[model samples]
Every structure is written in C-alpha cells, then in structure tokens.
Target: MAGELAGHAGDAANHGIDLIPIVALLAAAAIAVPIFKRLGLGSVLGYLAAGLLLGPSGIALIADPSSVLAASELGVVLFLFIIGLEMEPSKLWALRKQIFGLGVIQVGLCGALLTGVGILLGFAPVVAFVFGMGFVLTSTAIVMQILGERGELNSPSGQKMVSVLLLEDLAIVPLLGVVALLAPHEEISLTTRLISVGVAVGAIVLLIFLGRRIMNPFFGILSRAKVREVMTAGALLVVLGAGLLFQLSGLSMAMGAFMAGVLLSTSTFRHQLEADVEPFRGLLLGLFFLAVGMSLDLGIVGENWQIIALSVVAYMLVKAVAIYVIARVLKSDHAEALERAVLMGQGGEFAFVLYTTAVTAGIIDGPTNAIFTATVIVSMVLTPFAIIAMQKLMPKRVQPLDGVELADGLNGSVLMIGFGRFGQIASQSLLGKGHKVSIIDNDVEMIQAAQPFGFKIYYGDGTRLDVLHAAGAGNADLVLVCVNKKGDATKIAQLLRHEFPLVKVMVRSYDRGHAIELREIGVDFELRETFESALQFGAHAIRVMGADEIEIEEMIEGVRVRDRARFEAQVLGGVTAGTGLLLSNAEDQARESGIAPTVKLVAAEEKEERAN
Candidate 1:
C-alpha cells in the first residue's frame, strides 16, 4: 500500500500543474534585473546570474529546469512569430538577395570552413555537422543586448544583424532535419525522410489554417468569462498542448512553439497576448540560460582545459576570419567588417541543443562530446568580453571636422534628428506649420524607407557634429532631438548645446524622469511618448464619463500643469497634480476672475455715454 501511494504521489508530482517555478523566476528577476540595470550591465545578464543562483546547481530553488525549458520553447516561438509579423512579404522579398543569396553563401561557407576544422580535430561527420551548424549561429541575445545598451539597436549595423539572425532562424529547421537523419532511428530511407517532412509540413499548414479560423474566437469567449486563473491556465495549456502535438507529430516541441507563434503573429490581439505571455517567457528563458551555466561541468573544464582552450581559440579565430572575409567581399569598410566579425564569431544558444542531439545519436563519443560542450559554453561566456573588445576596437573611422559635407541645402532650418516614427511626426508637424525641417538618421534602410514616403531624411548619426552640420543644424532656428534612446537623445542634446550654443534644443524623452534629465540638460522642450498616450487615454475616459468638452479641456489643463512647463508650486509638489496642472488651472481661474472686471467696466462705460 505504501509503495502504491508513493507511486501515485510521484505520478502527481510529475504531471500535476505547478506554478512555483514561474513565481520564483519572477521574484528572482525582480530582485536581480534592476540591481544589474543600475550597475550599467544588462537585465539579461542579471537574469542569467539569477538563474545560476536559483537553479539546481546553486540554491536549487528551481530544481526541475524541465518546466522552464518547456516554457522557454514557447518564448522562442513567440519571439520568432513577432519577427515574422515585422517582416512583411514585400520586405522579405526585397531582402531575398541578402536573406537567401548572401545568407546561403555565408552559412554554406562558414559551415564548410568550420566542418573542415572540426574533422581535422578528429570529430565524426555527425558531430562535425552539428558543431559546424551550431558555430555558424551568433548569439542573438548577446548581440541584441549590446545593441540595446548602446542605443544602437536601430543603427545600420544593428539592422544587418537582424537580417543575418532572420536567415539563421530559417536555417535552424533544416539543420535539425539533417541531425535527425544522422540519428540511429529505425532504418528510414532518404525518400521516407523527405516524405515524412512533406507530410509534417502539410499537417502544419492544415492545423494553422484551422487555428486562424477557430483560435481567436475561442480565446475571446474564454477571456470574457473573466476568470484570471482560467486565462493563465489556458495559456499554459496552449503551450504544452501545442508542444506535445509537435513532438507526437515527429517534430520538435520548439518547432511547434515556433509555429504557434507564427499563427498568433497575425492575430489582431498580438500585443495583448504578447504582454500577457512575456512574464512566463522571460522566466523560462532566464532559467534556460541558467541551465546552460549549470551544464558548464566545471569538473570537465578542470580535467581538459588544454583541449577546451585550443577548441575555443580555433573556434573564434576561424569564425571571425570567415565573417571578416565575407564583410570585405560585401565592400564593408575596415571598421564595419571588423565590428561584425567580432560580434558574430561565437557559438549561440542553439549550439547546446544541437550538440546534445548529435551526441544522443552516437555521432559523438563521450570525450568528443565533452569538448564540444565546453567549446560552446566558453564561446557564450566569452561574449560579453567580445562585445567590450569590439567597443574598444571600434574607431571613430573618420575624425570629426568643422564641416564634413558642404552645406548643400539651405543652412538655416530646424535640425530634426532621427527620421523614424517620432521624428517623422515632428518633422511633419513643424513643416505643416511652415517651419523648415531637416531630418537625419544613421540607418540606411530607415533612410530609404522614409524617403519613399516623401520624408526628408538623410543618413547620419545625430551625435556626430559633422552629421549635424550636414543636416543644416548650424543655421537652424531650433534643434529637435527626437531619437528614442535616453543616452543617444541626451548625447545629441549635449552636442547641440555645446557646439551650436545658439541652437535651441528640444528632445523626445521616453519617460517623465527622462524628461527631467533632458530639462536639466537645458533642452528647450521635452516630450515623453508615454505621457502623451496617458493623457489621451485619460481624456477619452473623461469623455466617456459625460464630461463636456469645455470642462474636459479645463480638467486636462489642470492635468497639464502636473506635467508641462509650469511653475505652479501645487503642480510640482505634494499631494497635488504636478506643475503642469497647476499652471493650466491658474490660467483657467484667472480667466474666470477676469469676467466680472470686464463686465463692470463695460457697464460703467455705457452709463457714462448715456449721461453725456
């Protein structure tokens, strides 16, 4: 009876729903992410540290990483789904030359180069294949992390990284299919494998078509029931259920997650669902990184440091050379070629999965497997260093001079830094009001995108004094730094203020605190995107509450003194609307009080005229 009871308990534990892992991940991230953020590192690295501390290898608070792994697969799916949504057909088509042509060349050349190196080191063809494919992928997390930190995520280099990543993402599936073939599964012919793939793909298409017709409506009704637990439960069910279907259907759970993301990517409620799923995704991905850390196998490292060291060296040198050669072939400058080469010449998250699968397939013996794992992990561990190295190595390329380009256009105009969403809006608003505006950006793609839409955008970084002059900043009446990054925005504001002392500066800040910093930097105007959205949302709510337009306007004015250029003490301080509201309210009150004075003066004048 006791044995039976133990069996039942074990079964329940294995299959029963538990949310502790999710909760713990959140708590850990909440504590660690902000601390790391304050330290000028990144939230992701902090989360990685948190995972290492909480995972089985550390305190073991998150003992079973299986659940986290399962959830992480979904995160990747959603992430890819969003990528697909962002990449419309036209954009993808335009990128065919890069995505397919250049992408194939890079992947093929790198794989062949890496494979030759791997085999020469005595790896079986299967192990070499996995190693080569895995090494070909750069760390998306690391590259994006660095880009985000420097506010360079939208730069020309950044966009190139995106295109490269997208191509790698597409390549990952076929690489897995190749690995499956190397495995010692029951004797399946080549035709059988191809047929299986065709069938699986067909089924996926059918399921997706069915899902688009049925999934949203089903979710809508479920949501309307207003049960918080049900919604969370349903989300988990979707992830697991879809993952199970994928596995049973002879594909990876990760692949299933990816397909699920693709379907949801086109959904009308993508943002809302994404927001809801984010916490789960983040925790799982964090734990996944932690798992990678735990899998480091310090014992193996100690015993085989020599082999690991050589592998790591060969890995970086070969990959870097490959990328460097490719960049040069593409006609990239010396600086750009080196930067891309350094940033990408390392293994990534997918390496772990590929290596493990290859080993399970008898393609690698025990010792070879250990070395392979170590090499990948070392590559990951070296990424932050690589980024730092790249930063140090990245030169100014060309020195900043008095005038880089001739002031071809009219020199006197409003310098509009950034040509993306916010900047474009600003330029139009100013232009519609008859103010001359000159737009600038560092992204060639964004410049091209904006130009076709009739935007007056030029390619250049706002921080560069040369770009500023080229944008007619010297003679501009005012300068608007509408770039989205706090650092970049602040940097531009400082540059303009220092170089063109007479150019009035206005900056677009991300938040209230950011706006304060901009104001401290003497920015003539600071507009926070969220503040405007919040104001609009609040105004809509007031209208819904039956507030008249005049009353609503007055109330909005009151709110404004809480945010805008107002010296009203009440708005700026304790238990009241901020400075913006008070200034607007005071103005409204003064107008109200002036009514009686005007009426009495008018009546006295009429009386005097009648008396005369």
Candidate 2:
C-alpha cells in the first residue's frame, strides 16, 4: 500500500512538472516582449531573451532545446505560407529577373567573399566554402519579421529583399548537393546526382499540379461543411502537408509552403487561409526565436570565445561589404544597398543544417560546428541593434534629379510647398478656380511619377529659405506649407512669418496638439489634417448604427463645438484642462445633472463654447 501511494505521488509530480515549462514560456514572453518593445528593442529580441533565460545556459527552465527547435520550425513554414499568399503569380513572374539575376549574383559574390574569410581563419578550402555558403544564407525569419513590423514588405526595396530570400531558399537544394560532393568518404556518383536532381524537379512539378488542381476543391469542400474549426484545420493541413512534401524531397519546407501559397494566391480562399494561419504563425514564430536563443551553447562559446568572435565579425563584415557593393553595382541606391547589407549580413537557421550535414559527412569536427553555430546566433542577436545603428547613423540619400525641374524663379498667386496627397487635394480647388498655383516638392521620384499625370511639380526643399524664395514663396499672396513632417511645417511657417510677413501662411497640422502649436505661433490658418475626415467618419458611423440623419448632424455639430471649446481651453492652459468638456456615460453623473441626457449634454457643450 505504501509503495503504491509513493508511485502515484511520483506520477502526479511528473505530470505537474510538464506544465511548468509551458507556464514559464508564457510568463517570460508576456513579461519580456512588452518590456523590450517599450525599450524599442522589438519583440524578436524579447523572445530570444526569454529563451536564453529559460535554456540550460541560463536557469535551465527548459532542458531540451532540440525538441523546441524542431516543433517551432512549423512557425517558419506558416510564415512562408502567408508570404506566398501575398505574392500573386503575376507578381512572381514580374520579379523573375530580380530573383534569378540579382539573387544569384548576390549569393555567388557573398559566398565567395565569406569563404575566403574562412580560409584565412585556418579552415581547409572545402570546409571554408561550407562555412562561407552557410553564412551567405540570410535569416528569412528575422528579415521578414523586421520588414513586416516596419510595414516595408511591399516596398520596392522590400520586394527585392524578398526576391533574394526566395533565391536563397531554392539554393539550399543545390548547396546540399555540393555538400554531398565535398564529403571526403562518401562517393556521390554522377548518376546519383542526376537522380536526385530529377526527383527534386519532379516533386516540384507534382506539387504545382496538385496545388492547382486539388487545393481549391479541397478548400471548397471544407468551407461548404460550415465548420469554422474544420476550415482552420484544413488550412493547417495544407501548410503542413506541403511542408512535409518538400522536406521529404530534400528541399526546404518553407519553399514548399511558399509554393503552396503562390498557387492559392489567386484563389478566393487565400484571405481565409491567411487569417486562419496567422495566429499559429505568430505563436510558433515566437517559439522558434526562443528555441534559437536556447540553442546558444554557452559552454562551447565560453571555450571558443576568441575564435567565435573573430569568425562572426569577419563573416558579417565580409558578407555586408559584398552585399553593399553588389547592390550598388546593380543600380540600387546607397541607402537601399546599405540596408540590404545590414539586414542580410547574419547567418540564418539554415546554417545549422549545413553545419550538421558537414559534420555527418566528415567535412568539419563537432566542436567546430558548435562554435560556428554559436557565431551565427550571436550575429542574429546583433542584427536588431545593427539596424537601429544604421538608421541613426545613416543620412537620408538624396536621389539624382536628372530630368526634374528645379524650383527656379517663378510667379504665382499661391506657392504650394508640398505635393503630397494633402497638398494635391488642396491644390485641386485652387486650380479649378483658375488660381495660379506653383507646386514644389523635394521628392524627385514623386515629381517624375506625377509628371505623366499632368502635375507640374518642381523640385525644392520647402524648409530651406532659398528654396522657398526660388519657388516664388516670397511673391505669392498665400503660402501653403502642406509637408507631412511637423518640424518641417513648423520651420516653413516660422520662416514665412519672419521673412515673408506680408504673405498669408496656411499650414497643415499633424494633430490637435500640432494645430494648437501652429495657432500659438500665429499662422493665418491651421487645420488638423484629419479633423474634418474624422468628423465625417463619426457621423457616417452613427448613420450606419441607425441614427436619424438630423440626429447625426446635430451630434456632429455638437462634437465640433465641444471640440473647438476643448481646443481653446487646452491652448490656454494645457491638454488636461479640457477634461470637463468631454462626455461621460456614468449614471451617477447623469443623475447629478437632473436633466435629460441629450439636453444636458448639448447645454453643457454650448455653455462651454460660450465661456471659451
């Protein structure tokens, strides 16, 4: 009886311990992500920190890193799937040249440079080549996550980066073949290579066919079933299934998922698939980062610190320089080239696979693999900081104004200082009324793009006094400072007031506080950029919620009056001074008022307006 009781207790304790890891992971992520984000370090670093804390190198909260890494890889697969969903076949076709041409050249150049560095570090030629090539494969997760967070994934530069990443993914197969060929003991015959290549090609064709033919019908059936969970399950099934197919064929799981996404990009179910997989993708991706953090073998790093540090610095510097030079040579601007270089400098998760394969094939030793792996991790850790440094240190590049007309001596009644969306809209009414409006902008690309659309915008930095005068700001009856940056707008407004005192300055305010600041500075007219639009939006929302049109209009007017009063109070005192003008839905406050809510609210607002 005593033995049985002890056994049961032990079983209960073991089960409870299993839950500890899950709790620790959640708590660490919850605590760390917000704190890091608040510090401007970003969520990726937070996850990594959490992993490091929990891993054997820290507190050993999670003893097994490999299991976590294996499981978390699904996050990468889902991430690729979502990326593919955004890339339509048309876009992929459009990017073919960049993907193949730029991608291949970048890889070849970076790989060669990195390999030379490895050889100088005392590795044999073949081992150095493996090391170099491994580092050339940039971390897709890190780059993509950063790009997504910054909302740059759809930009031209962002698309180019994505193209390079795609090429890297495809290169993994051939890279593996190279590894096989380089294996000293293993005899890889020409016939075997041909067979492997044929298999990979056939698998790709089969996947494309099945994705085109079967996936939509399969999703259609799942949707018709009318079960939300089942639809989600089906989406996961497709992602995982596609990933598994590629993994078996010795290609990247991410590539398979990407291919799956591209095929379904034109499907009606693409959005639904993306929505279903997003939550999983986020959670898993976080887990993946944590696993990578945990995988940093502190013991190996401590012993091989000097060599590891040297390798990381040398590899990253070489890779970065190569990337920057190649990008510049390929017609990328200095800023774009530098950004790409910094972002793609670090070795990626794929490096682990290459390193491990090399070990298995007698190409490198176990200790060397561990040191190299640690080097990659450290590089990954430094990437966010590197990006931050690059942004702070790098000056904004001014594009060549080859064919763009400079804002030279001109005369017009209205000198519009910016030609952004706001300025474009503001100029329409002035131009429609046959008013002479001179438009000037510093963005050469925007000017060129707008030229075909009949916008006669000239290139000029509105913040500069000379540029303003050259753009006819001195002679204009009214000067419109419609630039988006508050600092620029403020500078222009101040400059106009000090120099062109006779000219009326109408400025676009970024927000309510900005509007108040502009008013305090004594601009002739200042409008909060989104104020009218927000009011219209609120009214439309009330209308949609079944309010009478008259009631909606009354509410809108009331809001406007109250807003004006609040703004005046805030300007006189501070932002907190207008709290009394705000509406309250509390029953106690309503009872204290002793009048119908609507009447009392309007009366209070009107009274506030009058007092102001």
For candidate 2, the per-residue lDDT at 303 reads 93
Counting clashing residue pairs in each candidate, in order, gives: 12, 0
Specify the poorest-scoring 10-residue window by lDDT in model 2: 1-10
Over the stretch 212-237, how does candidate 2's per-residue lDDT look in tens digits? Answer: 89999999788778898999999999
Give TM per candidate: 0.61, 0.67
In model 1, the runs with Cα more than 4 Å from the true position are 1-39, 50-73, 144-156, 183-186, 215-247, 252-266, 397-612
Cα lDDT tens digits, model 1, 510-569, are 876556556555678788867777877989899999999998887677567544543233
Top candidate when judged by TM-score against the true structure:
2
What does the lDDT read for residue 435 in candidate 1? 76
Alpha-carbon deviation at 312 in model 2, angstroms: 0.6
Highest-scoring model, lDDT? 2
